[model samples]
Target: MSELNTGDSIEELKVTPDKYVPHRYAGATGDFNPIHIDPEFAKMVGLPGSILHGLYVMGLVAKTSAGAAGGDPRALKSLSVQFRGMSFPEQEITITGEVTGVEGDQVTVDVVAAQGDSQVIRNATAVLEIPPG
Candidate 1:
């Protein structure tokens, strides 16, 4: 890790949610919506198949920000995002973040998550508080 500065790029994080991720995530979050756990039901509702939970993707964004801040999750102060497209399981998802501003110890990072050409999460931003040296 290097000194945080404006325009610096955060290390990218790549994840591939397994086929059973929806089922496991549902059990942990109690979000057993068929659109996330039942592929047949999701298809019936016009979705290609069961989709990954939006919060799960947001978690990745947060992880990226925290990772850029010395891997301390508590360093993340705030996060926001817009869900742009559906993401399916067993596909590779790439998360990237860029430092857009640095004011004092607060850093603002712009984040994005994509699957192939589809932008699943866009306009995402995160604020991190880095302790002064």
Candidate 2:
């Protein structure tokens, strides 16, 4: 793995959630909100269609940050995100991160996730604990 330094950009990650992803996520998270699993209900509620859970999009941010730390899940220390907009299924979500600070083995990253022209997550941050060589 390349050494992480301040101002360095992490590799971008992209994922396309299929239409059924919301349904499966709803079952796993027990968040069966109609807006997430029922397209008709979502439309009635003003959403374009069934939307992906906000937490799910946050998970993608965490995944991207962890990947920057050599793909080690344990390296992730903390994550915070602001849900900026709704994200729908079958659309590609792009996750990007940049190293904002590096102190010893701890690295802080600023992250963002977007779909098409809309940003699904913003003002996101992740701290990772990478071991010293």
Candidate 3:
């Protein structure tokens, strides 16, 4: 892990297939929405496999991005993400973000998570209140 500057961009980290995140998450979140657990259900939704919850992916972005900011999660003021596409269990998704800009004690971030031609989550922005100097 490296330190995040007041105005610095972060490198992207690919969520590898070894992550194997969907089926287990379905069980954990109780999101037994067949499209998230059953292949048949996924096909019905035009998906290749069970998809991860939007919040789950958002959480990942939040934590990893926070690392880049060198701040605690409690320092977060607001964060939001849009579900642009579904993420299959074995698909590799990459999370990339940059420090974008900063103002006063607030830091603004621009982020995106994608796999291949499919952009899973987009317009992911986070506004955080950095700790006092």
Candidate 4:
């Protein structure tokens, strides 16, 4: 959004998922899956604990993309992210992106959201239209 060019890095976002994130998310989205809200159930099912919802993490990545695209949701053309690993609550996930291509009014950006050394979102890409100055 600010004189964007290929290889330019977007402002990174640091996200620390709260301990109550899963509970709040469940209350808000009506997705009360035990794997996301019931730690005991999750452990019984072989998960380390109640994991954050995948869509929640994806939405955060999208929000980061929107911020990079001039903070206007309309500038976004498309967004995609592959869920490569689980993201646990109370862990910090860093959202980072770099401009990959620019042609005409379209700009492509490669993005990743990682927790520690693990990638929670991979193959993340966003296409946006640069608003006329």
Q: Which parts of model 2 have CA positions greater than 4 angstroms off?
A: none
Q: Against the true structure, candidate 3 has what lDDT?
A: 0.73
Q: Tell me the tens digit of each residue's lDDT in model 4 across 21-91.
A: 99999999999999998999999999999998998988888888888876898988899889999989999
For residues 1-133, write the lDDT of model 1, one tens digit per residue.
4678999999999999999998999999999999999988999999999999999999888998899998887899999999999999999999999999999889999999999999999999999998876
Query: What root-mean-square deviation over C-alphas does model 2 reach?
Result: 0.9
Against the true structure, what is each candidate's TM-score? 0.97, 0.96, 0.81, 0.95
- Per-residue lDDT tens digits for candidate 2, residues 7-83, read 99999999999999998998998999999999999999888889999999998899899999788989999999999
**Which runs in model 4 stand beyond 4 Å of their true positions?**
none
- In terms of TM-score, how similar is model 4 to the real structure? 0.95
Root mean square deviation (Cα) for candidate 4? 1.0
Task: Identify the superior model by TM-score, candidate 1 or candidate 4.
Answer: 1
Residue 97 in candidate 1, Cα distance off native in Å: 0.7
Each prediction's number of clashing residue pairs: 0, 0, 0, 0
